[model samples]
Target chain A: MTGTEPTADETPTTRSIPAVAVVDAQTPGNVGTIARAMKNFGFEELLLVDPPELDPDGEAYGFAGHAREDVLPNAQEISFDELVSSYHTIGCTAVTNEGDHNHVRFPFSTPRDLAQRLPTVDADTAIVFGREGVGLTNDELARIDEICSIPASADYPVLNLGQAATITLYELREMTLSPAGTQLPDLERVRASQPLLERLYDQWDELLVEINHPEEKREKTARMIRRVFGRADPTTREVNTFLGVLRRATERPDQEE
Target chain B: MTGTEPTADETPTTRSIPAVAVVDAQTPGNVGTIARAMKNFGFEELLLVDPPELDPDGEAYGFAGHAREDVLPNAQEISFDELVSSYHTIGCTAVTNEGDHNHVRFPFSTPRDLAQRLPTVDADTAIVFGREGVGLTNDELARIDEICSIPASADYPVLNLGQAATITLYELREMTLSPAGTQLPDLERVRASQPLLERLYDQWDELLVEINHPEEKREKTARMIRRVFGRADPTTREVNTFLGVLRRATERPDQEE
Candidate 1:
């Protein structure tokens, strides 16, 4: 399931490519703040790659304020490679269109521009934000289909991750003419559902080992599975597909070693 | 020494006309916040007209943040009549472009556009924000030379006075290109100066009493006076020349009175 491409039945019109992503994020405070911003803008799918510092109770609560449940606990955490491999139309926040992928910079895209583009893609879209201090490496930006930048002072070109997220989500939400599109619950409901990720993680770890990959490849393989679920944000059918994929991988019979 | 038109000898370049005016703005928090915003965008002048609610200490500190002293005491309190009679170009913050005043930045200027226009006007460019809840009255707007709007969501566009001020100033500051320009005040030294505007206010009030006729007309007279000074952030020479006019008025016996 992780390696498979979309089949014939995949709906191209449901463009769920999100308007935000956090890459190698280091702070839970920023994550929570970004979540609040996402909630405000009505975008729930949050993607994080290689987040090293995560404290749900301490930082996320403080930053999220009134809207925590809007944050997906199943926020897929994967490596840089898997993230690029999964998405068809990912925009990086680091470089602009003028910049080359090796010197990658996300070109400045107004929220209105992204809002218009979001609904057209066949696959999930990703808006990627980089780590707190250093931005996305040029190599990482290479995989992004669009590179957009927020025009800021050259004196201090970078925005605080939360502020950047807030502005993007706010703009997109502003463009949302349909008020009833997605009804978001409060923080408590989201927290109640976080345990689902923990359970899924346990199941995934078991399948990773049974695939009988070399020790060096086990973590890498497990991470790719995380990536697929992370970017796809699978609905019931997709989630079921993942479960079947895991079941088949583990149930395969081989000579006992 | 608070009001005067430009003299023939003065060659002009560069002006900072603020976009929001809080005439006789009642809330101290709002006032301080406006001051803080002015300081944020390098705007030092503020005009007040008939404010019944002002607690200098509590508000100046909170809104101005690190630059409390930047709130000039004279700007802290000025008669509306004085502002009106003094300014050559008093631009109101009107949401509409239908009025007589030509070329008001409508549909809002990008922060960059406003910044580019800053250097073209003379010293007397004023951005007038209205009171806390209800904005400036239509009659008040009708009298101004022009109107300026800071674009925001039409759904509920009223920005908290401070937040609105902050965004305006932030946009201007961001638009500033620092190279070849003199260095701005180091972060530590941007405190609001109170004494200069305070001294100017003393002279202005006395002038109002001098030029001010009929007790019934005194308050209305004051509002107009404030509007003038609000637009013309008079220089020291300009203030002194205007003061001389007022002093002479007081020294002479009025023929009618």
Candidate 2:
């Protein structure tokens, strides 16, 4: 997932992650954006069917971002026939048939469901995306082993090619890439300790007692404070700051009668 | 969700769907793509802080697609202060702090989590995206109420602005839009009936008997067939076709010894 370079060393049969295949895309910029999205989610192999001329200085490269170096340049130009025969294909389509009578589009899996199912299949898989406007032809869809659709508003379910690919890749990231090894902070380090929380609560209770005339409502107020802290999941630093503020308030002299 | 036109009649405070705010975006095309993505996911109001000049004939309009008429043209240009003051802001960032020491970027919610949490909050909400390059500055991030990060490959976590926005909008579509009311076929209509499935299984059993298959293996074979059908979830037509094929094979004339 870390490396952007194509895994030429590993044969297609051995590859675990699905190859991203774009079929007859109209815009080179869209292709580039798809490649960029592929890289973002850690997909390496890109298969292009009937691709446009990708001039190095053209929109394809210009929009590819870092993918220009790897995914875009190393894209495999393949035929539609070759795509279906070479790998177990899942065609990504926005428009779907209404009834099961058309088996090609019916019984489609959402990208989320595919992420769970595809990993168990012991075959090289390719996720095929179609043209921006019309999407995959019925002939092409029939040939593909399965169909995957992104759930969008029925009003305008047709996501642009780049977006459809990006969302699909994002959903499949769990299967394609390992958990991010980046330097992002761990959640556990931020959670305050139980003792610290208890001390904070004790301080709050004392403050309520010192400032309040209504003894019956003090317990309810204390419970509410606890619930707020529980929901916030405040960091250790935050807890300490809160503790400090409460301590100062609790120790303060009562106002003159 | 169906309408592309802005809801001019409803006040922002009264609107349920979160407004999308872009802060200091560099490219007009990205803004256009973001607007298109907004329309795709059924989000309406768009707020821009220090946005690029979106000319009528420029890339912004060109990329806006159908959104050019509504989301793009009607985008409200406001200062960053106005953005934070008016709505409960959620900042979207790719890079995050590693430790609790820097509270600004730590403890961020993923888009999936936000979809669940944001709907419960009564306040008018805004999902604020930063520049294409640097993203939201530390100063800007500190002012935001909460942070949301998309999970990506550690190697290349930085998604382009359009893809990032598109994915975020897609995740939040559950809250923004209702379930698709389009003519897409329902799953129940296609599912083979239990009786039909049983008949198909009976034909398969008859075929195995006619072929003089080992009696011990027949039960296992039938069970395997059942499992296959269960997984395939074939259409009524598919089940009937399978039944016809099995019946023909079972009733075929036996070859002379």
Per lDDT, the best of the predicted structures is: 2
Could you say which candidate leads in TM-score?
2
TM-score of each predicted structure versus truth: 0.41, 0.87
Q: Model 2 misses residue A119 by how many Å?
A: 1.7
Model 2: per-residue Cα lDDT over B1-257, one tens digit each: 42433487854443378999999999999999999989888888999999999999999998887888999999999999899999999999998877677788877888898988877666689999999988999999999998988888777888899899999998998776765443244442367899999999999999999999999999999999999998888888888889888887888646435
Residue-wise C-alpha lDDT for candidate 1, range A1-257, written one tens digit per residue: 53235667864344453646788777786787676666545566777777756565677665564455546464667666666777654553533433212223423354446656665444656677887666676676767766555444433344556555655565465344244332211110111123454456556787767765688987776777767656433333334445566666777545346
For all candidates, state DockQ relative to the true structure: 0.01, 0.40
Fnat per candidate, as a fraction, reads: 0.00, 0.52
Instruction: Show the lowest summed lDDT stretch of 10 residues, model 1 chain B.
Output: B182-191
State residue B128's C-alpha deviation in candidate 1, in Å: 13
